[model samples]
Target: MRATMMDELHKPYVDTARSKGLPTYKVILKYPVRHAVTPLASTIGWQLPNLVSGSAIVAIVLSLPTTGPYLLQALQGQYMYLAGTFLMMLAVLTIIGTLLSDIILALLDPRIRLS
Candidate 1:
């Protein structure tokens, strides 16, 4: 991702920053790093749900009291309503994670909100 970000940066932007007497660190931060943050946040945001929920297989195998085992049991018992509710809850959490990522992105670069 860092390599891709570096490749995407416009040379003119770097040149302009350098011409303004910005040090290398400042120039990189103002140009490439800042611009890269949005996509990074987006990737992290989508993965946040999984991180928080943990691996269902691991949870079930370990007999943890988290949602995974309950969801599995609901499905196995043919309890459609309960299974659906659990699925919905998971979906909501994913949406919340994505929204959090967007908020972080906006905070990191206020220009995003303006556009």
Candidate 2:
């Protein structure tokens, strides 16, 4: 995120905003920060699945009474229906996360259109 912001700071539009005599804070917020956040919003969608998977692994390793261990057991036991349901849930979650990110990206960056 920091790297993105730093890169955005050097973009031509930011320079143009500065040259136009916009206030420093307004220039930074309206141009560079807005542009930098688009990447961060997109990344949040991808991170959702990673967070779930990481937590599942942690839950299993810690022997927590959670669905993570149950999911593993279901897979190992050949419980096809249960395993399929769990996978479907994960897919749904991924889709929802992506949808949310798309909405946020659209809101933050005028270049993105939902249609």
Candidate 3:
């Protein structure tokens, strides 16, 4: 798998980081989530659908006061365009997020930078 190979290539940096008492996984975990707080892990975790689902639930709760119903109605009314826009946005976000993850991973692991 690509991840496995990347990890192997980065093993030296991982070992170095661990030797220095850093959470070496930070270099590898970014591929799946994103959080501005811990940019690396957060960015990698951002890609997992579970994070999106959690956000949606929070949004729904927050929207219960004023905007949720109206937005739901609008989306239901414009089903076709909504679907198209959602798909396009999803693809774009996915690509951009992955690239950000790769860049962060490479920066964290010097072995990756040499390549």
Candidate 4:
């Protein structure tokens, strides 16, 4: 059902819609076609490069503090790997920051994600 809905949203729709006499972008835009974008983003959140995306993965990784030198420092406390952890956290935080960015983009443009 979702795939069908998305197929209808695009122009040409894999070049098949044209053969069936479906409206292209010109006709669709003129007809004021609009759809909500939030739910789709919400659905895509799991695999996206943001906090909600793969957070489960990170959480599992972080739970084990004594794994890698990088993850070791990231836990908390002045262990011998403090520097390594700090840098590791910096990288991880930067990667996680994309979550905020995804949120901001979604907010700024309700139509950021297509139907």
Structural similarity to truth (TM-score) of each candidate: 0.75, 0.84, 0.43, 0.28
lDDT of 3 by residue, 1-115 (tens): 4555454544565566556765646744543222222344336834743333234445676864333344455477887766565556556767767777677766655445653
TM for candidate 2 is: 0.84
Candidates 1 and 4 compared by lDDT, better number? 1
User: Which residue pairs come into collision in candidate 4?
Assistant: 73-85
lDDT of 3 at 53: 28
Best by lDDT: 2
lDDT for position 89 in model 2? 77
Give the range of the ten consecutive residues with the poorest summed lDDT in model 4: 29-38
Residue-wise C-alpha lDDT for candidate 2, range 23-44, written one tens digit per residue: 9999998988888888789979
Question: Where is model 1 more than 4 Å wrong at Cα?
Answer: 8-10, 57-66
Kindly indicate the candidate among 2 and 4 with the higher lDDT. Answer: 2
TM-score of 3: 0.43
RMSD in angstroms between candidate 1 and the native structure over all alpha carbons: 2.7
The sequence of per-residue lDDT tens digits that candidate 1 reaches over residues 1-115 is 6875777466787888888998988888777786777788878877866765677899999988887888889999999999999888778888988899888888877787856
Compared with the true structure, all predictions reach lDDT values of 0.81, 0.86, 0.52, 0.48
Error of 4 at 32 (Å): 20
Query: Candidate 1 at residue 8, lDDT?
Result: 48
